[model samples]
Target: MNVLAFFTATVQTTRGLWRIGQTILGIIFRHPIAGTSIIPILSDGRIVLIRRRDDGLWALPGGMVDWGEDIPSTVRRELMEETGLELTKIRRLVGVYSSPDRDPRIHSICVVVEAEVEGKMEVQDALEVIEIQAFAPSSIPQEPMSHDHYRQLQDYLNGLTTLA
Candidate 1:
């Protein structure tokens, strides 16, 4: 194989193995973890999503919560870190997505939130985020996405006419 292709395959394999290792470690050492996923909806009724640098799927902007981090604060920090937008006010709890076999790295609970934001959004962290864009709730991308992001988007959209 070409050198570049070989390197890419090697790295992907390593990452795959690392995730499997993490899952096994979780079984031995950790409980179901909690994380946040933020849905940043713009004034025009469009929702924001991030193209992950590693996988290229347009997922909602968010990250894992720190040990003592409040969920709103976690959403704020993650939004700004990934999209350069500050969370103004959390609109509502969009939904909670937790399945027994959702992620390979851990048995995790994802607390999804819908929120308003300030400032223009962009992909700020080059290592983790690749692009940021807004889409009408009806037209979230069809490409591969990170876990239940699409479902979260659907939940947010379905709730737009009422309280979530």
Candidate 2:
């Protein structure tokens, strides 16, 4: 092979090996990440949910807690980012979910909170959120939701504080 072709192959091989090594190291040393999931209740008592762009399924509005940010801040940021709503008040803690399989993308511990929210419902993070809507408690979609959101919502609706 030409010297140029050999050099190109070597560079590509090195890049691929570097990526594989990074992935392995990341998995080995990674800890469970903390995040917040907000069950946003509007003034009229409707629950706000977002359709995830990744799975095209409805899930609670929430995200990973940014470095140096507390749970409340993460809740507020994620709520606004996903649903364009401002937190009026945090009503209650729905649960702390630490199951390794709760999120398919990563092993994340989610702090779920029921919060009173106000503002127009728009998709703030278009890349992550596909659609935003408010549903009556009795009318939440019955089909399986993204991640473990179904269990989270059910626990909230049942007035139970969970720790799992």
Best candidate (score: lDDT): 2
TM-score for each predicted model, relative to the true structure: 0.77, 0.84
For model 1, residues 29-141, the per-residue Cα lDDT tens digits are: 87777778998978787888899877678899987676577898889888987899888799888777778665555787888888988789876666678789998877889
Q: Where's the lowest-lDDT run of ten residues in candidate 2?
A: 15-24
User: Model 1 compared with the native: what TM-score?
Assistant: 0.77
Q: Which pairs of residues collide in candidate 1?
A: none
Stretches of candidate 1 off by over 4 Å are: 1-27, 160-164
Q: Rate the local accuracy (lDDT) of all candidates.
A: 0.77, 0.87
Q: What is the TM-score (0 to 1) of candidate 2?
A: 0.84
Tens digits of per-residue lDDT, candidate 2, 1-164, equal: 99987876776576446545544554788987778899999999999999998899999999877658899998888887788899999999999999998887778889999999999999866667889999999999876899999999999999999999
